[model samples]
Target: MTRFAVVAMMAVALVGCGGDGGDQSQEAAPEADAAPAPGTVTIVEPADGAELDAGPVIFVMETEGVEIVSAGNMDPGTGHHHLIVDADVDWTLPIPNDPGVHYHMGLAQTEFTVEDLTPGEHRIIAVVADGVHIPLDPPVADTITVVVR
Candidate 1:
């Protein structure tokens, strides 16, 4: 046989040997049917309905399925925390930056301190919001009531 014929035959054989004798469809693998868990936020320091001494209250927050990032980081699945104290949130708007009511943790801080809480029951909420201080959709937040003596 000529060298050209031999080379052609070798190439054909190599191509034929590259696949199994079964179906040769190039379909992609099926994606997983399970969906991702929803994001959430929780208060980690004080248990709900707990009474404590009156002083600087330290609030610690935790998040799941989302990362805590500084303000202006509009990346998906990342945001900072907001501590809303004794005030209702207007979910349609961005979280307020007013102190003692809406405390914005724009620095990505997981914990914050509020001093001189009056001797009474107070409602505390930990909310996760985007870089622009807007609360997350479906509102990833946790609320707890605490009493100060």
Candidate 2:
């Protein structure tokens, strides 16, 4: 082939060999906007290891991919919040309704206030439980420690 013809053929081959002309930006968009996985829960306030003055402690909780409903709803993918304070949890059994230890938010409330903490360090855990106050399988919870002065 002539010099010009050979160069033209090489140019066409290079262009054709390039990647599939799909938009890379579109391919990455979904991952950036993806929703949280099912049963994801987190504590939004009073960051871990926080130190605060002794008094009423307010807790703010958040959940993703799970619906917060009143206790006894018995609906799939739905439950309420429970605040476990400075106590060991029995994941296989129903959370007890004990004061100053296991606080159940049966009304689907996301915020809670604890007014009975003594001055010291305390372990706080936010747990999501089913309508019957039983924790979900695989256990959706967030634990943090805070010191009260």
Q: What are the C-alpha RMSDs, in order, of all predicted structures?
A: 16.7, 13.9
- Give candidate 2 misplaced runs (Cα > 4 Å): 1-36
lDDT of 1: 0.81
lDDT of 2 at 133: 93
lDDT of 1 by residue, 12-86 (tens): 986887443122212322346645645678888888998989899888876767788899999987788998889
Estimate the TM-score of every prediction: 0.76, 0.75
lDDT of 2 at 64: 61
Candidate 2 whole-model C-alpha lDDT, 0 to 1? 0.83
Residue ranges of candidate 1 with Cα displaced over 4 Å: 1-34
Model 2 per-residue lDDT at 97: 96
lDDT of 2 by residue, 14-54 (tens): 67864432222222233565664457577877899999899
State in Å the error of residue 59, model 1. Answer: 0.7
Assess the local accuracy of residue 60 in candidate 2 as a C-alpha lDDT between 0 and 100. 87
